[model samples]
Target: MVSRRGTKSKTPGSKRTSANPPSRKQFNPSLHRFQERYEQKEFQAKPHGIPVRVLSFMGVTVLAMSMYSGYLYASYQREVSKAQSLDVPRDVSDRYNSTAPTFDAEVELSEKAMRLGKKRGDLIRLARGDVLEVSCGTGRNLEYYDLGERRGTDDQGHAAVIGCRSLTFVDLSPQMVDITREKFQAANPEFTHVAFRAQDAGAVTVEAPARVRDLAGAGKDASDHRAYYDTIVQTMGLCSMADPVGTLRHLGEITEPERGRILLLEHGRSHYDWLNRILDNLAPLHADKHGCWWNRDIGAIVEESGLEVVEVKRWHFGTTWRYVLRPKILCGEKK
Candidate 1:
């Protein structure tokens, strides 16, 4: 015990009273655990988010690329298939030998025609179903014929010709057909299904009588009719024909009654007075240089051939006048 005096203090041997140590605040175990988990979660989440996002984007890109590749492959295959199946008649060699135009000049002119035709967009819009392309020349218009995009299905899902088929190319010049076949084959291997026939546009009866006979032999079934074409396309062919009007009439007669649509791209008489005068003056020289007669009014001939004109567009390149005509009977009526 210590004395009570203010300065007395404890006895010399007595132990001094120690100050109490500050009590430690108890730690919250649950809060510490929560903080540890949050930090761990943040660390883990940072690594996963970037990879997940990158992987997702990569997946989308790969899918898009795959789809595009498939589309290109299909298109290429179609073209190649068309080329392999193309048939050029033996008569083509003789014709090419006899009256073949200058290759360079023909190519240049054809390129010009294709460029102009593409701008019109009528060719692309008009080609559908069982298409018959007359004077098809090397199947340059095959790109315009959309074959892979047909909708719906048959009982067997094996596309119907009338409702699902694409373009058929026909030409009088066997050489022309062969060249076209090769070109398309090189470009689109899959489209080999497109048929190419060497035959006269004006005299279809004389050209492919065997095919016609075979069809007649097949009897008068609707399937046989479906096997026939639903549309006719004439491109720069009528001018060279012996009888343009008669040929148009014949085509009209053979087309499927109510479904036939005729799309014509022909160069003919100019309506422009000045241009017509120039054509008239150059007629003899033009005919001698390029076996093409500029005086025929192809539009008038088509109108008179019992085909109702659906649309008529005129294009003038230099002195040449071209007409794009869509012909059909009113209300899908048969001619």
Candidate 2:
């Protein structure tokens, strides 16, 4: 009332205001709703974006691992399939032909092969009259024959004696046979007892004149259909053959009935399960590359081939086997 007396009269429904005006309580429902919506979206968007990014990273990781595993499995399968369908003739022939000229040096220098150490010497001692060495690449066994000694002068003017003998060397590769002939001849110019034949051991029928057998000082033959050899030797040769069991069976067919035996030195599967599994996993790759089955079971092959195993000795964790096998006997012939 006192202020109204000092101030001019206001119009109807008008009110006098102070120097600092009070805030109005205006209603703005649309603007408030918009602000609430924006805050809610920001809160939700922050957490949601983080989870999406994390999920995407995990998905990519899993997908990459799965693809890598699939690739490894596919590679393993390809190796296995190739091993399963391995063809003996083509693979072996190609392998020997490719390696024929230098096969002997390769065997001698290989660390794994050199483990056989003196076993080759032991094998040479086992050779007798009418001995035959199959798959005799470069005639490594030629120098160990049981020939009588001849007195000679050594390079140092010392008395030396050389021992040699005549033996037959057989291989499927003509190149290998040629190499064997050259190697043996070069090693022994005077010893003319070696005969090299390029023929498949599985297909060849054993035959020789009775006079020749007598000259070789071998025993009489057992059957008209089969020719007899005093000793049949194979070393590390069975692994590359198409059918080891079949070859053994054929050996049985040709062995002398009364007094014939086969001597073998070979590398095969380990007796230890752990090592064997590793070999199994890698056998296909090894065979593909080297042309031999490194993981084959020598004892099992012998048993399955129906050859009467006289003795078996294992070395190098059962990877190397020395076997003496008697000829196969017919069911009716068993004593």
Best by TM-score: 2
In candidate 1 the C-alpha lDDT for residue 134 amounts to: 82
Error of 2 at 39 (Å): 70
Q: Which structure among the candidates has the greatest lDDT?
A: 2
Clashing pairs in 2: 147-164
- Quote the RMSD, in angstroms, for model 2: 18.0
- Please give each candidate's TM-score: 0.55, 0.62
Residue range 114-161, candidate 1, lDDT tens digits: 475474254555555666778776555655665653565544776544
lDDT of each: 0.60, 0.73
**Total backbone clashes of candidate 2, pairs 3 or more residues apart or in separate chains:** 1
Runs of candidate 1 exceeding 4 Å displacement: 1-115, 152-164, 205-227, 317-335
lDDT of 2 by residue, 42-107 (tens): 897675545777899999999999999999989978876776675433244457788776666776
| Location of the lowest summed lDDT over 10 successive residues in candidate 1 | 205-214
Q: Give the deviation of candidate 1 from the true structure as CA RMSD.
A: 19.1
Q: Measured by TM-score, how close is model 2 to the native structure?
A: 0.62
